[model samples]
Target: MTSASEPDGRRQGASAVADVLKALIREVPDFPEPGIQFKDLTPVLADRHGLAVITAAMAEIAEGADLVAGIDARGFLLGGAVAHRLGIGVLAVRKGGKLPPPVHSETYTLEYGTATLEIPADGIDLAGRRVVIIDDVLATGGTLAAARSLLAASGAEVPAAAVVLELPGLGGREKVAPLQVTSLQTV
Candidate 1:
């Protein structure tokens, strides 16, 4: 069990870690399209100390989760590490048509068009399992919202969502209002 002083100490340590991560993040202009500034975390992932800080913070927030539902690609990076730290399994939330069998899906509005995400029904047996949805960025919250719905619809207990960064202008929190949302950095 952690002592009373542990939480504060952890916060201080996590903040230091965030500083290192922030420094490693690269500013990539017009990535995937034009008129968009992307904060690439690839460098952060490459840094051992940065990764340790992030994983520790994630594990702390994931205190009671039975499973970590990682939302495709980048989420897998954070989720895989967090799952290892927490000694839990990871359920992948993938783009539509990617799963092999008995998949469940949810669709949401995208900046251009509608997008769909899928999760295998047997992935995490939602019956009474505690779930934490993780993603790399919370831009419009459409993907994460869909992921959360898919998890809940599949019978998983989704109480919270986690992300490395969140764009407040996009109202990502409102999109996943049914569940608590946490982000390491806000932009």
Candidate 2:
């Protein structure tokens, strides 16, 4: 019986829910590799609305994202749902050795020389497609930036990147300044 404009208390509750979810995120020291304090989103993902709210926010920011590219691992969880909401395709940007034959790859600098990312040529047709890269955290921005480059090589247009959390102090923002970046929670 409520009008569309009428504030649905339930829907309005999403923000509050997001705040708590943000709090639930745990910091794991030296995970996946040393000197990296990974922002573990598993706890947040376990909550129903936590995941729903995150996906909805990412979708809203994506606006006209024709495709959603999730950087391997955690990125998949967010990207898959956002792709569903947008009724578009999802692309997976994986580690060097993950993709099968006919894959496109790009290499970016690490503290060392470089690291590589790959995307299956058949994963998604990037010709004239506009994609939004999604990830759980924007740390050094190397992975996300590399993913963007890989998508472009496939002939896709990447207008933005979205993450659940962004570590502002890490200079990740400066690395991706050219792209529209959005994070539900920034630290």
Candidate 3:
């Protein structure tokens, strides 16, 4: 149960883990677009120790959540790992058109354009369930914010969100204000 604290008293957890992430996270310039440097977590996720540290930290942040909602792609990996660590089920928030009809969807603006996220409208009882959204990175925050809204509309309570990395200059924190966000590292 390793935990670290931010200057604001928010528990970030395990400086050693942060160090590992910082070391392992690969930075590529001009990815997906010009003037955008991408921080790829593939290496980090592939490393056994890196995965363990992140899973533990994220699980701690999502301690009280009944379910973990992972965003469309990369988030699925972290969400599954954290949910497993916490002994909770994971809800896959899919991309638009990925799931069959009768889906709960929310569209949001991305840095480039726009995208939509969806979850099953039926089969899963979201009413009154507590959820924690997990993702690999928090950039513009459009994806996470839309996921939160989608979950809330379905009657699920989103108490908090966790991510491995946060790009503060993007204003994601301000955009998702009022929702507690825990990030293992900020760049």
Candidate 4:
């Protein structure tokens, strides 16, 4: 339904949307802890244009996915929007113990501590589904990697992951090795 040039045009569009996101992100230094500069995307999501831009761009990247997997909190927001755009469903990948028993969980180490991601082991079978993981940011890639594992365990083929922003030094892209991660913006 589109020409080869369409991909390039889409890339340009995504780049422009990323520019919009960069302006709206709030930089908070040393809030939760020392030596951590948190990139808060609340303001970006709150903006009418920001949300529209990101959702569309991410949806484009999520073209072939049958389902969208939203990691914990923020990913829930992006996943809903992107899935809606794609006319598909969004899976809420929750924090450990949030869901009832019989859940599939993958635990990973974080910079501060350890965390786990869980999904229903039953119901809404994810078997053979092509899923794309959406998250707000990619830091250490621990969370993303865990989510990929959880989904793969559920029999879903996680072909790709997308984030609103990616912190370069964290080696997040490398951490989720071979699983393509598309960061709308990097800072």
Candidate 5:
């Protein structure tokens, strides 16, 4: 329902979301290590319009999904907001060890090491469900890929993924090849 209008009377979903993020995203050089310019989205998510615009846009991209699988950390924010707006349930795909036993886990490589993502295996029946993976940023796509694999293992159909920001230079999009990724903004 939240869309940005252009002079041509057309809606610019990604452009509108990008405009909001460009105004609020914080940039930090050499974060977590040297030569890394970190795009901190704290300010963006904190702002009312920023959050609303992104949530609405992502919800549109995740249309037709029966369930929303929010990746660990920031993904939870948008996932919950979108799912609520769409009147759907949000499944928390937490970090490794965050959930109790009987969780489906998928491991992926990071820049320095490896990380794991998990979801409750017994409580939820993901089989035959259409799921959309939501996350705050798509940097390298490892997390997104892992989430897709984890969800698919549960017999869910991961048709697509949505993210607030994408660092294209990092090859995140290419890393998740075959998985359509809709990003609100790229910087």
Candidate 6:
């Protein structure tokens, strides 16, 4: 049961969170490779207030999700925070070779190369679970698309994905067509 005022409060909170992200997120050019600008969210995640605001906003978007699957590395931080806020479990979608044998995996192409993501096939029961994928940024869409497929192959229903930032120019949205994506901010 929520009051009408609750929505207003959340809206205001989300706006504030967006401001925090925009202020703290760093833009570094020629990172990892030439002619590429990378958006670093490490500062935001390290800030106490920033973490609370972003986590709350992400949790709001993940309301109906039964489970939260976070991409390897940075996604793990955001996913863990959002899952904790929602009182749900956070599944770490690990990088290839990080997990032991008997795992579900998917590989996708990156701008520079190809990478694989994986999850345990034996320990967790993903069948019939409603999941929301969380990540720091949506770039090529390959990572996200692969993650969604991996989840589906394990019998999970991924209704939506939440990201802190999205590079629409990269055509990730189009790449993962049919999958609703919610981005806090676009760059």
Using lDDT as the yardstick, the better of models 3 and 6 is: 3
* Native-referenced Cα lDDT, model 5: 0.87
- Higher-scoring candidate on TM-score, 2 or 6: 6
| Model 6 misplacement above 4 A | 1-14
Each model's lDDT comes to 0.79, 0.79, 0.88, 0.87, 0.87, 0.87
Q: Cα miss at 21, model 6 (Å)?
A: 1.2
Best-fitting candidate, scored by TM-score: 5
Give candidate 4 regions above 4 Å deviation.
Answer: 1-12
Q: How would you encode candidate 3's per-residue C-alpha lDDT over 98-156 as one tens digit per residue?
A: 99979999999986689999999889999999999999888888888999999999999
Best by lDDT: 3
Question: Model 1: C-alpha RMSD to truth?
Answer: 3.4
Model 6's TM-score against the true structure: 0.91
Worst 10 residues of 4 by lDDT: 1-10
Lowest lDDT block of 10, candidate 5: 1-10
What TM-score, over all chains together, does every model reach?
0.89, 0.84, 0.91, 0.91, 0.92, 0.91
RMSD of 6: 3.3
Q: Rate residue 101 of model 5 by lDDT.
A: 93
Tens digits of per-residue lDDT, candidate 1, 41-65, equal: 8888888877777777767777799
| lDDT, candidate 2, 38-92, per-residue tens | 8778988887767776777777777698889998888987889889988988888
lDDT against true structure, model 6: 0.87
Q: Kindly give the number of clashing pairs for every candidate.
A: 2, 0, 1, 0, 0, 0
Question: Any residue pairs clashing in model 5, and if so which?
Answer: none
